[model samples]
Target: MLQKMSSVQPFQFEPEHEISEDENIEDVQYQINQNEDDRKVYEVRVGQNGWCLCGYCLPMLTGKESVCCKELQFFAVAVPDIPCITAHTSFEAVCLNRDVLWAALVSLHDRESADLSYRYASYRQFTWWMHVIRIRNIYSEPDGIYAGFEDVDIDYTEIDQAWRDW
Candidate 1:
């Protein structure tokens, strides 16, 4: 269990019609919605292997007069703690910041690629103790999912040399 954050709420997935692992996952239709301010709650349907849910696309940059040029599918997944190298696929095991994690999965469009294309970092996340961390990349490999992060301590953020090096 995790302590509640200021604006985020923690939730668990309890399927109304729980099914066994041997059963088809498509049959398990369950969605857990949280408050509008709470983006942590999410929906997860059990699959044959475990969690095979794909993420959704980012908010499209609509209209001809849109501020941004292109609509990018940017997404991220936050966890209660750093995940083990081997347990990447089993995100639920470690606990997930559902909405963001789901968004990240949706961006992949059902592909299993680990490389991300966008250059500029769109989001920043903190660890369990609230240490600021810069999300470098979140991608999937043959083994499972991985989140690359850079610790942004005072030295890194304050020192000019450290900033350039990082």
Candidate 2:
């Protein structure tokens, strides 16, 4: 009789320090900002133990036709804070509110580049999504919609015509 070998290893998880319990929200935000400022590239330590299951991993394990493969047990770390917006099986996409996304963009723009940095496409995609969400009022209720920074500007066409005449 031939014996089947299973290569699946025990899942190991490393617990991350909770960021929300800190006394001041500003302090926590500052720490997040500082961490972003100090690092060049963010590392996603998948399958290293304590990291959360990204959208891809979650559905693969729990979906109707779950596979019993060892490779499926591994985890991955992609760009930190850029939610997995791409998994096909997921029912809903994670949406960050406009203010939060804008703040993140502003912070990213203001920070000096570290050795590790997010890919240009990823940053652009997130910013574009945030802009779309702001225009659509995806986060707020019917009467409580928030206006984005761009709404404050006057139309450039009038200025262009005046400058042309001058």
Candidate 3:
């Protein structure tokens, strides 16, 4: 596992005018460069937090917006040793932060729960480490359900673990 993101180098890139075969990918549910014959790509309009919600317009962009969801080139980033992030949007920087990646690979157990989002970078997270991570009050543990907007990340254990792992 990567000890720590040591450095972050954000660069701007767009899907090739004709995307290369290797560039096409399907991971974590987002598809890239499909229908090679069709030149058009899905237009991911910006919602409140800059993530695209599936078609029907959300009256107000409220939902758990995934920063690394393959389709965006925009999002924030946290760099090495330095406790900060920079969003290099427009085609490459998906909601990727150094701490989140570090924790998932180097610290987080395979089953450890976490909620990595741009929200962590917000001012609200200044006191975020005080809370404890717990199953949402809504569900019983081990239900195999993914937590969404249920205040799962209020606890900063995941973040703490990331730094420890680093």
Candidate 4:
């Protein structure tokens, strides 16, 4: 199992922390400067411990990963063409409910090669962790009434679990 898990390549990206808590959704999108044509729509899904679309979340959902199986109370979506979005709540609750959505943009900075350095080690860098990005407005699910991010539930959990699943 360890070997199999190790075989998967983790998605690469950077975090966008420019969003201010007081900023409106439209401003947030403008700050990112992502064009609609370049933007991609990623369906939400449930992974192992929390709802996430990382290497761990993808394999564990298919019974391929078993080391840390736990209740699913989180959500995440990562696409090569768009920013990664995720949300989570406490596992002790009777039902999962998330009120916040965090976004991480793809990395635009990279070094030419890995070179050891005490002060400048090559590493994955994120400007911020779990930064909140506002949603413009509530959008309806495929077969349901209009709903906000906080209202997203099990209905959206299985949309794209097979993405990069091994």
State which candidate has the highest lDDT. 2
**Candidate 1: regions farther than 4 A off:** 1-97, 106-120, 125-166
Clash counts for the predictions, in order: 3, 10, 5, 3
**Which model is ahead, 3 or 4, in terms of TM-score?**
3
lDDT at residue 85 of model 1 (Cα atoms)? 21
Candidate ranking (lDDT, best to worst) = 2, 3, 1, 4
- Each model's Cα RMSD: 20.5, 19.8, 18.4, 22.0
Cα miss at 156, model 2 (Å)?
Answer: 34
Ranking by TM-score: 2, 3, 1, 4
Top TM-score prediction, candidate number:
2
Runs of candidate 2 with Cα error greater than 4 angstroms are 1-15, 18-88, 91-110, 114-130, 133-137, 147-166
Candidate 3's residue-wise lDDT over 41-138, tens digit each? 22333244344323323333323232333333232223222212322231122245565455434322333334433434332354334332432332
lDDT of 4 by residue, 113-136 (tens): 444222122222222222222111
TM-score of each: 0.15, 0.19, 0.16, 0.14
Kindly list the per-residue Cα lDDT of model 2 for residues 1-166, writing each as its tens digit. 4222232111122234566554688888888888775442223332232233443433222222232222232223222333443432221211234754565455445324552245544564676776766535534567766554332123453334444443
True lDDT of residue 19, candidate 2: 61
Q: What lDDT would each prediction earn against the true structure?
A: 0.33, 0.40, 0.35, 0.31
lDDT of 1: 0.33
Worst 10 residues of 4 by lDDT: 99-108
